[model samples]
Target: MIEANGFSLIGIYGGTFDPVHYGHLRVAEELVEVLQLDHLRFLPAHHPRLRNAPVVASHHRVAMLRQAIHGNVRFSMDERELKRPGETYSVESLRELRQAYGEHETLALCFILGADAFVKLPDWYCWRELFELCHLVVVNRPGHALLSDPSCLPLALRNICQERWAAHADALKKISSGLVYVAPTTLLNISSTRIRTLMASGKSARYLLPERVLDYINMHNFYAGGK
Candidate 1:
């Protein structure tokens, strides 16, 4: 873990990553630098609570992710959600991390997510407890607007986050959990859905994702024939 201000910061980036693409990588990379994260864990969900199961198999998805983040020391995969049975819940994984670190460790967990996801916070399982478990780093997506306007958030979430907003990213280092920080990252147009569509139609998806991951997908013929 990277030490800063007497604390270790670890970023937990959770997503389906059906086929890891440049969009996901660029955002994570920016967050790592913005948050001064020691390392960021890509927590791929086996079965997300709010969305349908991934189109690709768990093993294949995991393999692609490994290749996609191969040389990035600040990025690594966390197989906890993939190995856990049943639908994946953010609360459970964060709890496990906290327990593993113990109550006395000088560690900070930052949950990196997009603005779109943050607005739907109440729909998540044990959403409020998330604040007690880790700080939230909400990044602006291509189409989503900033949360600066209180009206942008649902009434419930807005009220809960009213006092949780941090003035800046550095505030996360001062507190272990229970703070919200909005980050501005490069808005890469790449998306996994578009890449999958191209692959299914026997079209080229080069440059949208890493060559290593694209090569793996081609070798296995994944997402083709409608998967």
Candidate 2:
């Protein structure tokens, strides 16, 4: 079992993490501070639903994430989705967390998503059930716009966002049922795709990702040898 390390409030950030980069970590740091989270959980999906299966294996993704967050006591990685078979869905992972954490009023779990991903929320499996499971922390990054107009949201999500948009960070700590927070973060312009491309062409993606992670990629020949 992964220890929460005395963290009552946690954020779940799930993604392919093919090779975790600084872009992913930078935003996480800001969110942890802004939301006052005890921990920001990095969850690497075993089988992604919205996009193609990650080119890198799930085990590799997990290792890279572990290396990326090694020193940060408040940041940890979970392997629940990696252990499960079939396609991984955001809602299913959230359900597992809700079950694990139980009904503690003091415990808060926030699901982190980029603005691009949030705008496409309706496409997720059991998307509507997400709000019932945990708070939604949406952040803006390149090529994605944070939704401001309620009309732009999916019909099903509009009402919930309208009703539950928290005006302050403490508002999220008050209740566990439903909360929508759009964080103004220090969004980095890095992308895993670009990193992979550089590595494939024999160029270094050194500073983009953690040093150990890059070493692991080099040792394993991941996205190397002009693939």
Candidate 3:
């Protein structure tokens, strides 16, 4: 285990964020509180590799995200993935972050992810090298099962999960290379898929999305029966 030097924690929250909603915002908020993070960056992927491309245009998606996260001082947007060519991968972004922040012995660069995403870590690009760059803070989300036993997971995933699992945020604070902490976050049962479908059906996605984001979507008439 690498030594923890009581470093400043910078949380990374990345997603396609087809539309930023309370599900995304609330999770980030609780994580900042639970981890006592110094800052949290909301990264929107331009071209995600594992999933279908977002229906909304890149500029519009970024605009909605910016409006959604507007007044929060600690929350900020990182457009590295958005600006990069080719499909966006988490490891690429993390590598850039490591290069930028690795010099500080007293800095913990953490990447926050959902349990659904974390379970599929084996399929991600340079996933093994991921631990070397930053610690993973996995937040539990609805509709995903958390495998309690390591043996039940894939060989690579089982090995990593068993070896790096951390019981507390302090455990992550004390190390650099390998630490995975599972966080119990607020269960907001909202998804971009559902949001899109609802809007396409001409239904108001009022509380599921932020007022500003809803307004943007309405103004653009996006997802209006798009198949």
RMSD of each: 2.4, 3.9, 2.5
lDDT of 3 by residue, 89-156 (tens): 99999889888875777787889988888888899988998888889888777888565665656788
The residue ranges of model 3 lying beyond 4 angstroms of the native Cα positions read: 1-5, 225-227
Better of 2 and 3 by lDDT: 3
Candidate 2 lDDT, tens digit per residue, 77-113? 8888989898989898899889998876568799999
Residue ranges of candidate 2 with Cα displaced over 4 Å: 1-8
Clashes of 2: 0
Candidate 1 vs candidate 2: the lDDT winner is: 1
Give all candidates' CA lDDT scores: 0.88, 0.84, 0.85
lDDT tens digits by residue: candidate 1, 53-165 = 89998888999999999989888999999898999999999999888878745788999888888999999999999999999999877778687687878999988888989
Ten contiguous residues minimizing lDDT sum, candidate 2: 1-10
* TM-score of every candidate: 0.94, 0.92, 0.94
* Candidate 3 positional error at 216, Å: 0.7
